[model samples]
Target: MHLFSLTCTDFAAALHQGWGKGMFHAAAIYRHVFKQGNPDLAQVPELAQAGILTQELQSAFNVSSPAIAAMAVQEGVTKIVFSLAGGLRVEAVWIPMPRRTTLCLSSQAGCRMGCAFCRTGALGLLRNLAAEEIVGQVYAVRHGLGRAIDNIVFMGMGEPLDNFDNVAQAIRVLSDQRGLDIPHSHMTISTAGLTDGIRRLGELGWPGLNLAVSLNAADDELRSQLMPVNAIHPLAQLKQALQDYPLRKKGVFFIEYVLLKGVNDSRGHAARLACFLEGLPVRVNVIGCNPGPDCLFESPGEEHCRLFCAWLAGEGLFVRMRSSRGQDINAACGQLGGPAH
Candidate 1:
């Protein structure tokens, strides 16, 4: 019922139905909601006088902060706690870099994927966030940052593909020019190898949106042990899905490999990963595991991480070892759903 969550087209329809106003109100409403303007119908005498702001519509349409419960800032990253209407709380992280600011959104309250190293999996599946809730996170973050975000990642506290519809709708809304005005290329959806969702996204032919697969382990057996979702959709099926996906010009898919200490950080594992991505146009991002008390997995040392990236680079693969950010605030990768502010 949140008006801030609706797409421009849908909001226009609602305006026409409620107040007899046509598409003329779409742009104004979009600006009101996304541009941080007042959305009160009482403030606009025309809509109130025309009976466009009906009691039912007024009750249903709200453009306020109902989802945010708490917020904390650490380093350059800001962590927000969003309390859904269903009584479940989820976390979102805002990461600010020198060049660009990126916000990480959660698709679900907790998670069902059960990745052994993920803290969110420890909480199990609570519920999938509605489209409005998913988009609402961005709205909340934008207000907090006092500026629009440059990038967004669906890699917060849940498996995004499991909640595909809402996530996709959120993406469309975020990329809409009338709304957040974020480009598709600036958005990324990271998944734990959900082949069905990948196929659906590819079928939609939404070019420019980035895709990142959480392929922590190149081998099926090791992957299954780390992520239970892999057992359902193995590497073979996932690889086929990636191959079938249509990529836009200069679009290179991302392979996100979390280097676990003595686990998936070996030179052999790196070689296997290079072999697995042999023919695909991909850039490998090696992240050292961000350890939390919820998971026993320890992050690989800087030397081990360097060695892994070196091995992949030796195999002629583009590799970057990304350092974990906001560790002090517990806002780094794989640290959500843990005991932190």
Candidate 2:
């Protein structure tokens, strides 16, 4: 069993069943493993006090993280490639800002969404990561890189809702008060128009958890061409899902629009987008497309992006221009993939 895969309550139950330990002892173990960054059960002083041998715990549970295969840093952004079992790999990015640092995490080894603008889609879906693997990314960055992650975004290598079970469990583990203590308010899950997953997440009723929808184009035909998921869940269905999504007080949905030159950056496109988002409480985040090597699309000019945002704002919608980070090292948006890419 992977120790990191278990939640605090699950851990407590395991300890009770295996060694007749109390819930408080499980809490102590959680502190040692997650808060103190000590994965070795032998080093947990509380476990020793409970007369639990290190060998017994070791034989039952594995507390190992994936090996870091490669790391690249450009500007204030750092991308870490973790080599998982069976030679599969995933990437997570550390984005530092003046106010808060955000950690972008991957939900799977590769992506199956097949969005035309993203590099990870080129790899197809390899496998969904386990809860331990998902949580390990946070631990690896916090402990290995020694970076303070103030926020977490599931916008790295894969569509998070595709691996909803593992991702949800990872959130529970990450937010446990006895462990990492990061709240749901600091976490955001982005999807590429997965209506069912969006509705499922809403049904979870997780308060303060943010949701971002990648809507590159407002019109169904254009969006369907850019994102294959759109062909399945068209604009009408996606809009209905958003309309039904539960948002906390003072919470608003985030609409991520990647601007491609001469493609989806026109003022007319922005007007259609505003119309598409007419009833939703959303803040539009306009980002220039991060075109990696041999990409079919091109990033829009700064003035063009500015104009697009202006158009959205003119419609009385909240808008923000997100500047690309780590583009020089191919760690920007839509650029995460294996080392070979």
Candidate 3:
């Protein structure tokens, strides 16, 4: 593993004691590797002059490639399939907005949370990506685009919380001031209702980090049917976890509700959802299901999505409807699964 694979603190600890260069060198190296995506460490003047960048460090630590095997773009939403070490493939989506460009990254090769609507879940969990692999996705996309990315969401191919340790390190790497320097508030981790993960995040005390829970169904029975993870950590337990979550006073967590036509989009379901999230500080993001060839679900009509948002708002819940961006290229939510060639 190279220095690129390690966290900032871990990289600092690995420096030679005799060099006495300290964190100044580590920060400079990180800036070159992460912020600039410098492929060759010897190109960096600070590392080169110190004589510490020896053949040993070169052999032990190497820069990870984003390994973009394939790419598809539609209406400015670009999805790139990244090949990891060992032939495992993951995805990252780049969405360019007027204000900020956002990259949705995957923490695992595939997903274990078998949400009925998601194509990635159908593959099962392949393996957890290393912290460097996670960082490599950002480096690859940004390097390819020749642009800066302002936001990141772990909502591409896996449940981020399931790969917590690696994901956490990646977050630190991305937000490090001498590195990518993305604000904590700009990075969001979306999970498939993992209460343990939620509790663990709370314990970490990173209050500014945003958490989005996929609560596709309001009722326990319906939710369990839609998302199998609900059976292990049901709605009640999830609610308790959110209740105990130490959110910042101004922070509002996201509630992602994927609307499956006639399944979880009924007016009654909306009311039940309102009751379920009664006193929580949340903003419900209503996503119309992005249909895939193998999936049985379908998205509700535009009017129905509007009504769902209206109904949630009627119950005094803050709600917004987000349309699927890249359906033609299979880059939309629930449609990110295929052989990574």
Candidate 4:
């Protein structure tokens, strides 16, 4: 048995004791309670295990419980929304594909970035989720899904760079070999082109960690209209920052282009994009725009999206028409902001 210092990590772990937190490590936690009473228990369950456990702690020493604890895994989709200690709600989505299950985790609650088209930033920034709050998303997902999620993407709710420290700590926790043991190679952190923040990420020396810039526009003027942060951290500086973005031993970063109709989906925009991406070995994940209350943004028609992608691909760029997932549940990219409607 090990005792962790009451560090920020420990603080986050302590908060995870209750609340909608703790996923697989809930077993490790159950293991802790077991060690207190029995001093040794089955440390871990094998990979092929399934089902659930309801640890109804005695009333005399009660901890915490949600009104309901629903546990089931289907279609390899084991998703759990962890309501944190302060009405801060973020989630981790585990989608089991034929070969792997990826976890989509949130870093903040309401985003402050105010990216006009994104739903998450609609409320304009609650507070930065703690490192624990950020990491707890994964922990709770592990508990709910009852399996090791293969991939992690920080494309959930908040603007991670704003809550920079906590997000960084949570990344450390996620990649830590001690608990979750998620390899850095399989994890990704996407930012809305925060240049200084990207520079810091490079300075941190996260080997094999993937960096994604949400560059939905090709020029600064249009980009500022979309991502206000661009007004402060211009794309020119962002490009210089990327130039310094210590690419991990031959790692390829990504530019996430959310294709908006009549916005950044034109031949001129594609050319600007190709030029913007000059002298960089990178890939672009072209995502069709998702609808929001601010319906001014339109997803490019299928033909247009394909044509733009073809043009960029012809320019010798690595491009992927990223598959849109969970739209039926309103759980697609740039979704997952408010209460389920």
Candidate 5:
């Protein structure tokens, strides 16, 4: 359910709305209303109104409990995985080319980015998901495939940086030696460049945890228009913050630039972008813009895309064109879950 309009006390009041008797009674009402039988510490009343028995549902959806969500964990060039979303919808996909089995996990119900080209961000923001729910996605995937997921990407539904604490907590829980035990290095967190959150991540000193910044545009003006967060954070400060980001063993942050035809794709624009990252240790992963409904931006021509990468490479920056995998399913970078199935 969407909690945007629900205040803490409002949530409390909902639980207390018709709370009469045992937890199951409240659970029944919450299930009927929210359609999710999960309870959180939003407030006792909200707990009551929501009628969620968190512990109960956690036990119920445990993939390891049933030994499902996994067919096998053997080595493979490519492994199929699902992009789990809120109860509303989900995306099933495969990992990197040739050989891979990694699932991208969504830590929230919906997104608030409202990026014109993105499906999930356009859905507006939903409530932040708890660590269990984040990990629960893995469980669902495991059960679906009856095999273990090798790696994970936090580049799914919502902005992971928006749900920093829960995202970090989920990583800890999933990496628990006794539990899923996926290391920090194996998981990745992609963002639309949340400077504050990125700074916070630097303090943890977790080596090998990959990061991808959704920098669809090269300059500030276009970036702010395409990504609202750019207005508040700004590209200058973001670039500096990224430079300060502690990278383990010369790690390079992935600068994901989605190319569009008329916008941010001209040779002049490419040269300007090359100047933007003169000495940064970064890799440009040029992604093809997946045309979405209501998006005015068109994908750049193949030649222009190549030239853009070439320009950046001439400036001594590592640049590469990202292969369009699952494009038919709209599974390219920054494309994932949404409201409408």
Candidate 6:
């Protein structure tokens, strides 16, 4: 059994069947592993006191984190490349803001969504990460890299909802008070408009969990051209899913709009976006495209971005222009796993 893969409750159940121990013992083990940053089962004093042999515990559970292959720092943003089994690799970013430090985690090795302007989509779908591997990123960040992360965002290599099960399991493990203890409200799962996954997530009733959609375009024809997922879950259907989503009281959806120069940055596009977001509780995050190594699109000029946000605000929509960070290190939005690899 992979120790990092199981939540505290699951671990307790496993221990109950193996050594006839109760939840207290499992909680003690979890406190050592997650809270104390010790992964060696042999080093857990609780197990030793319970008459469990070190060799026996080692034989039953596997504890490990991803190996850090490379890392780069630009300004305060740090990008970490992790080497996983089978020679596969994935990337995560550590972003430090004034209030909270955020970690952008990858749900898959590569993406299959085929977003026209995204760098990770160019690599295609490599494989979905297991629950252990998904949770291991947090372990590697906290214990391996020694960084303090207060927030988590699934906005890296792949579309998060495509790997919904593993991501959900990881969230459970990450939110355990005896473990990492990061609140569900601090975690955001961004999707490429996977309506079914959104519905399934809504069914979990984690009202504090945040949801964001990568909505570069408002119209179906243009959105379908930019993001192929739009072809599967059209704009109308996606809008309905958001409307039906059980958002926490006073919580608002985050609409990520990557402004591609001369593509989706025009005033008309802004107006269309305003119309599409009408009546929805959302905060529009406008980001200029991050043109990594050989991207076909160009980043929108500052003046253009300013005008676009102005138009949206004129329509009474809450808008914020997100500054691109880690572009120098290819760690910015839509820039992971690009030609730098």
lDDT of each: 0.84, 0.90, 0.86, 0.69, 0.65, 0.92
Question: Cα deviation in Å at residue 85, candidate 6?
Answer: 0.9
> How much does candidate 4 score in TM-score?
0.79
Which digits, one per residue and each the tens of the lDDT, describe model 4 over residues 229-310?
8999988998898888889767787999999898889889888999999987789999898886555687887788899999
As for TM-score, the candidate ahead, 2 or 3, is 2
lDDT of each residue in 1-341, candidate 5, tens digit only: 22222323333455455333444443343333222222333333544455566454334323221112222122232222332343344443445434556777776767887776787787787677766567666655554345457788887778888999888877765665434557777888988989999998888778678988888776889889888889988889888988899898878888888887888777777777777766777888887787765667778867778888888788777899976555544555556652212
Rank all candidate structures by their lDDT, best first, as comma-separated numbers. 6, 2, 3, 1, 4, 5
* Local accuracy of candidate 6 as per-residue lDDT tens digits, 1-341: 98888889999998899889979989999999998899888888888899977787678887788888888898979999988999998999999999889999999999999999999999999999988887889899998778999999999899989999989999999899989899999999999999999999999999999999999999999999999999999999999999999999999999999999999988899999999999899999999999987799998888889989999999999999999999999999999995333
Instruction: Give residue 274's lDDT in candidate 1 (0 to 100).
Output: 90
Q: Pick the candidate with the highest lDDT.
A: 6
User: What are the TM-scores, per candidate, against the unseen true structure?
Assistant: 0.95, 0.98, 0.96, 0.79, 0.73, 0.98
Quote the positional error of residue 246 for candidate 6 in Å.
Answer: 0.7
Of 1 and 4, the candidate ranking higher by lDDT? 1
- Candidate 2 yields a Cα-based lDDT of 0.90
Q: How would you encode candidate 1's per-residue C-alpha lDDT over 177-262 as one tens digit per residue?
A: 88788888999999999999999999878888999999999999999999999999999999999998998977888999998899
Task: Identify the runs in model 3 with alpha carbons over 4 angstroms from their true place.
Answer: 17-20, 339-341
**lDDT comparison, 3 vs 6, better candidate:** 6
- Ten residues in sequence with the least summed lDDT for candidate 2: 332-341
User: On residues 135-191, what C-alpha lDDT tens digit does candidate 2 reach at each position?
Assistant: 899999997778999999999999999999999999988888888889999999999
Candidate 4: stretches off by over 4 Å? 1-79
How do the residues 1-26 of candidate 3 rate in per-residue lDDT, one tens digit apiece? 65546766677777645455678777
Question: Candidate 5: which stretches are off by over 4 Å?
Answer: 1-87, 90-92, 338-341
Q: Flag regions of model 1 displaced more than 4 Å.
A: 44-51, 54-57, 144-147
